[model samples]
Target: MEIDFLLVGQGLAGTALSFRLMEKNLKCILIDTPLANNSSRIAAGLYNPVTGKKMVRTWMADYLFPEIEPFYEKLEEFLGKNFLIKKNIYRPFLSVEEQNEWMGHSSDPLLQPYFEKIHTQALYNEVNNPYGGIMLKNSGYLDINTLLDAYASYLIEKEMLMQEEYQEDFLEVTDLGIRYKEIKAKGIIYCNGLGAMNSKYFSNLPFAPVKGEILDIHQDFCPNVIINRGVFRISLPNGLQRVGSTYSWHDLDTGPTERGKRELLEKLEKLIFIENKKIIHHKSGIRPATKDRRPFLGKHPGLESVYIFNGFGAKGVSLVPYFSKIMVEFLLNGIEIQKEVNISRWNQT
Candidate 1:
């Protein structure tokens, strides 16, 4: 079959790309192999406005959030699914320094737009609250795994996906175009998450893969909203909650580790009481973190028809809706790609 585009890997990047392509009435086939060790499959699908220890709002929040809101809603409508929801987050202040930290920044105009002034509260006085926190608005979570499964099913039903290993050798590229198996395609895009760590075509870019561990705890009582502290908790509709997510840049193993569990528990102990809880699941997955920590997008310098859309890192939840839409426009129309995220930065280096 002849097609307009051929995509490799069906994780968030590929899935998002295919969705947009189909929206443009493009004929595209996705070749997916059961993901190797680490991809976006295990992502918590979290989007935090203030990140890191300093609590700075992410870049381009003014532009990104509004674009992402309706995109996921549309996905929910199309798939008959409901993974994305708005639940307020409770950010507990760790110490007096932390409270002073928030107060010191109340005058900053850039941060003011993202949230309101800190209000005093004692939700966990018995637990730990040297100070309190300001509630963040316009933030939420995405059920990444749910979206992936639903999209996979949609592709299978439409015969738009293949379950097999995608070897680059199968892609016969020439001055004219590209070919794979029996089909000819105008362009081929690789949205494989960490798999690009070793892709011969785009591996020249500074790609950093980080391994992270997530813990599922079944407890007697838990808050419906996501709670932020030393360790954050996102509530699942399934009644279980996801926590921890310690990032390890050195070891990229997928096996559950006792160290991550103990570390997360040590942090959790400072606040909530963990008396009678069942440790249901513990697994590790790697994210395609980039060197500068920005997403890597756009086309390859050498290969004209091959493209990439990866390096979402931990912010896949928010980045997906914004960047994916932009990518679709760049492909369907003659729109100029964002320079900061373009893979061409590494060009001529």
Candidate 2:
């Protein structure tokens, strides 16, 4: 069947892109291999205005943050599901000097939009924030798995999704477009996460895959808001807290390791005062990060109809919504992509 686009990988990138494409009245089909360890499914789905140890504003915070709530809320209404959770993020100061430093940052005009109240005392006695902390506004986590599952079911019911492994050998590129088995489309976009590494059309780009592990523990004393310090502790429903994310560039397998668990526990120990808790679940997934820490976007250099929309790394929850709109616009109207994220940036390397 002829369609406007054939999108591979129903992960966050593919999911968001498909929705954006169909919203524009473009006919699209999504193919996904359910066996693939989808990083989007396992992600904690936190979108913070401030990131990193230094706690600087995230890249494109102004543009990216504004689009998040509306985009997700609109999608929620369309799918008839509630998955967006808007909550505060409490980042405790590591020292008095850091607290003083943030007090000065509070007045900065650039940070005014996301800046909330800065506390001189601990917001919660249950948590280990003796040095006070900064409460950021417009920050929260998305229930990515819930959204993906709901969206997948919607796609299935609409007959727009195909659950099958996409093999390159079966693809035939014609003058009109591309054909993968019975599917014919005017163009194809690959949002298959790290699976892009196997594509002959765009494999030369740098893809630094990192393994990340998360744990769901039943900690009673965990704070209501997300606590960020050495590690991030996100309060979940049902008296469980999700603590995570150890970045390991060497061991790129999608398996939980004892070392990973130990690392998370040790880092978590410094942040919260939890002594004992039952480990509810352990999950691990590989993120498709890049060398320069930017997403891979735009069309393949050799093939006009082939495009890429992967490499969102740990920031997929925030990045995908904004970039997916750009991708759809670029595909449908030939609009130029952002220069930095464009795949052409890697042409010289």
Candidate of highest lDDT: 2
lDDT string for model 1 (1-349, tens) is: 8999999889888887788888889999998875542457677777777776667788788777776768888889999998788866667776777778888888888777666448565664433554777667677788877888898899999998888988877789877668999878988888888777677788788888888888889876566667777788876788997886788898777676888888877777766665566778987888888988899888778777878899988888788788988888887775878888988777723
Q: Score each candidate by Cα lDDT.
A: 0.79, 0.89
Lowest summed-lDDT stretch of 10 residues in model 1?
Answer: 121-130
Model 2 clashing-pair count: 0
Candidate 2 lDDT trough over 10 residues, lowest sum: 33-42
Q: Which residue pairs show backbone clashes in model 2?
A: none
Q: Model 2: residues >4 Å from true position, as ranges?
A: 35-37
Each prediction's TM-score against the native?
A: 0.93, 0.97
